[model samples]
Target: MLRVVRIAGPATLVGVGFAALLVALAIGGGAAPQLLEDPGAVVRFGLPTSTMLVNLAASGMIGALGLVLFAIPPASAAYGRALDVAAGSAAVFTVAAAFTGFFSYLSVTARALSFDDTFSQGLGQFLTQIALGQAWLQTTLIGAVVTVLCFAVRNQTALFFVGLLAVASLIPMAQQGHAAGTTGHDAAITALGLHLIFAAAWLGGLAVIALISRQIETPKLVDIVTRYSSVALICFIVVAASGYVSAELRIGSLDRLLTPYGLLVLVKVGALIALGVFGALHRRFVIKKLGDTGRRRHFWWLIVAELAFMGIASGFAAALARTATPVPETVPATQTAAEILTGSPLPPELTTANFLTQWNFDLIWILVCGFGIVFYLMGVLRLRRRGDRWPWYRTVLWIAGLLMLFYVTNGGLNVYEKYLFSMHMFGHMTLSMAVPLLLVPAGPVTLALRAIRKRDDGTRGMREWILLAVHSRAATVIANPIVAGVLFATSLVAFYYTPLFRWATEDHIGHEWMIVHFLIVGYLFVQALIGIDPVPYKLPYPFRLLLLLATMAFHAFFGLALMSGTGLLLADWFGATGRDWGVSAIEDQQAGGGIAWSIGEIPTFILALVVAIQWSRSDKKETKRRDRNADRTGEAELGEYNAMLEKLAARDGR
Candidate 1:
């Protein structure tokens, strides 16, 4: 079985992916019409084929880098081999992306090939000047950079950035796919982006491990395989989830499941389920007994089968990228300026009644908040099952935080935020301030540490990672009260006064990034103040109080700056919203400042009160400790002090 797998694994991967692509394309009509006037069969079929290679190569590069940085030790021979794999894969990615770009240009423009100066100039202009061409150009450049970095960089810790760059290189491809100029574009981008990341991790990991399996010592091989398996498991879950999302965006409804594109999706789904089962078998039987030669033999065969299935899934995905969806993504016409800017029609003017009803759901945040509530409940249940006590209020606070987060991101606030600066700021405050205030006290980290059983295996489990993160030097620095306080206050100015505000408002990626930044900054600040999660260290009560006061003062100053301002911050977006129902955008800006000042202070006060209570409790605890010491010794120290005083007096008399 081992010999068979060793020989057949890579071949099976390519073959299965190729077969799956061919099948899916035949079903979905991926072939463009072979017109007499158009570029010939080479160009026609070569485009999709190039795209499929690009995906495969990209997955290999990203997966290898991730495995190196996360699973394999830097000192191991396998680590260097993994880098070699990444370098090779990245080279392929770079080449394939460039070809895919050229093919894509040909597919779109339907021009004949030429190597003349005019052709060169036209190609340069297309790549350098156009958005669609630029996306591929950027991807190619990023791939090239990652390829070089993989070869040049050997430090394991620094390779994380390389992995990030590799993953990020896929974003442009996602953007260039069939999602643009559609209502589901955001969903498509998100789902596609996630799919690419997880899929790369899954596919690339197997390839790297298979390539380097012999070089790894038997002892380390087991550990590496176990870690990679963990990564694969997570990848499976995320891939499945993201696949569902992407399918929904493209397939639209279950009624269309019988359509060619939907059938392709079903095929991909089946492949994923098979991969999941393989992962489970590996985890249950093989990973636990890697030292057993017989078990290891079976594992290699299982890995080969898993690779084949992964290839099928990847092939289907590549074909699906080429396949046309049944529903038209294009809107008939958007007449309004807001529609032109935002891609959606201008919502009905904001009304009190609509605050409860209006919604522009962010699929990502909904999943996030939903998972948050689910996991927290799961932790609580785990604790209860083990006869452990967790504070009910902490659970309540966590639920409230997640619910509020969901509402802020997906409800009335999100609906109006694009057109209303005030609402955007309100959402920002809730995200960065109010939500953290609720969430920090929930002691999520503490709960996790207490609830998650420790893993003694060489693999770093979730609990280990959490502990490492908290105790890490980076955490220690960021968790510094001064640093957290400064960042919390300075970010508002930095964000609003720079291009960041514009980007956050204008782009979906930027918007999501903005939410994440706000939430993190808020959590850091609140954690510095009154977080129940154990940290590297804490400041004294007086310093904490001082820090809170200083933060509030800065907050007030920021509000005043906004309130006294005559110019609108985002005049272009909010100013031109064309709403007559609400107060003027400038007035709304001032009102946002007022809310930032007043409503913001309420949370500050709560923080201050909590800090004061903690201070009092600390003093009481100290007093009780001293009293207990006195009771234990019965004032022996006091008698010694009197005797010392008497001896001093006698010496003075003499």
Candidate 2:
């Protein structure tokens, strides 16, 4: 029965996906022949089909690798087989990507196919120069690299990085989607990216399980399925959220639901709902019965059904990419200065009320904040249930910090940061200082270590990974007070003075990277000072105080320099925002400097107070230790000291 599932699952997935894609394309006019620049029926139809294959193959590669990294033991036969699956899938991804690229070029140019220098040159230029062509080229190349790495690398840690590379291969595809230049472009891109990544993880993981079920014992298979189910649950939530955002952007209104694009979206939504139900059944019913051989066949058959639904979702998703959106994704005819510079219209004037009330949510940070809070609470609850005492203050602080992070990322700061230098600085300061201040004291690492179970079955679990990271040499180096302080202090200059500032401002990916970089830097620095989590090395209280003071001084100096500067940072971006209201670009930059110097220093001062309190507590504890020792030892050390003093005095008298 398992063998039959192994064969039929993938066949069912491909067959169903192809069928759905054809039906969707037919209904949506996605594959219709162009009247003016028809690339022929072959290119018109083949592009979506090949792109669909690319999605399928990429999913298979990423899903298998994820299972291997997080669930399967490296030494197991299933691990190697999963890698083989990834490699094979990657190979297919490479070929399919290349074909999609070719079809895309033919469709765009509508040029006749010929074996001539001109045609070859045009193809070369397209792949190298054009953004769309470059995206496909990058995808194909990355797929090829992933394929080779899967075959060659066996170490679990190395494979994790390879998995990251595989996931990154989807970013270009996300960029090429319908929302690239539209309103809410960043939100759309983020949603689509998350959708692709999590959807692949969900669909491909089950396929891997089905293929490898017969190779493993029933007990182990049950464990693997349980783990995969957890991942699939996360995928389901993210896919649903991202799908809604994508649909909202593309359809624009509920009334448009009858359009071909929206109808395809509905089909995908139905498929997602069906897949979610299958996941629920597996967790609630089928997994427990897997121990009984009599019920094993039912599990495999259910997997077949789930794969069929996943196929429908995948196919509609691909077709929807090519389908025309109900709302046109075009810029306004009369672009404002804000729209010209930031690709968005000027928001209302920056007022105190608007500052607090406005919002522009980022899906990525929204998920991060949600997951961070939930997992931390889960860990805390687990500790409590085990009769361990976890601090309520820590939980409060953790939740508060994540909420602040969410606000900084998704609220008013995000809305105006693109148009105003001051707003960007304000958000940056909050991210690097205030949020980390709250989070570092929460001791998330310690909570995770205590809550997650230790695995000794030659498989690395969350506990093992956490311990490995904390004890690693890199952690030791970075956790050093001097190093963390230097990174925290000097990064401001390095980032703002270099092209990094411009990149982080203009590009969504770069913007996200900026947030992560500063947040981590601040976390490491604060953790080095007052964090409850264990570090490889720590300075004495006095030195910690000294380090904090020095770092903040340097930080203040950076702000002063910015204030005194006659020039503006990213002059083109901040200066060119054709706004008739608010401060001039240079004045705004100076105000940003003032914010960095003043508001940013508030958290540092809090750190100083905490360190001082810790110092006083340390002295009190030392005194108590000595008093106890004297009590236990009958004051023998004191008597000895007195006798030595008397002997020295007698010798001086003689």
Query: Which candidate has the highest TM-score of all?
Result: 2
Candidate 2 per-residue lDDT over residues 1-654, each given as its tens digit: 567777999899999999999999999999998879888989888999999999999999999999998888777789888999999999999999999999999999999899999999999999999999999999999999999999999988788789999999999998888878768888888999999999999999999887776677778888888889999999999999999999999999999999999899989889988988999999998998886653588888999999999999888888998899998987768777677666678888999999999999899999999999999999999999999999899999999999999999988999899988889999999998999999999999999999998876677778887888899898999899899999999999899989899889888889999999999999999998898898999899999999998998998888898899998788777888887789898999899999999998799889999999988998999999989999999988899999999999999999
Q: Can you list the residue pairs that collide in candidate 1?
A: none
Candidate 2: give the clashing pairs.
Answer: none
For all candidates in order, the CA lDDT equals: 0.85, 0.91
> Clashes in each model (backbone N, CA, C under 3 Å)?
0, 0
Compute the lDDT of residue 37 as modeled in candidate 2. Answer: 80
Candidate 2 lowest-lDDT run of ten: 289-298
Give me the displacement of residue 222 in model 2, in angstroms.
Answer: 0.8
| Candidate 2: Cα lDDT at 96 | 100
Model 2 vs. true fold: TM: 0.97
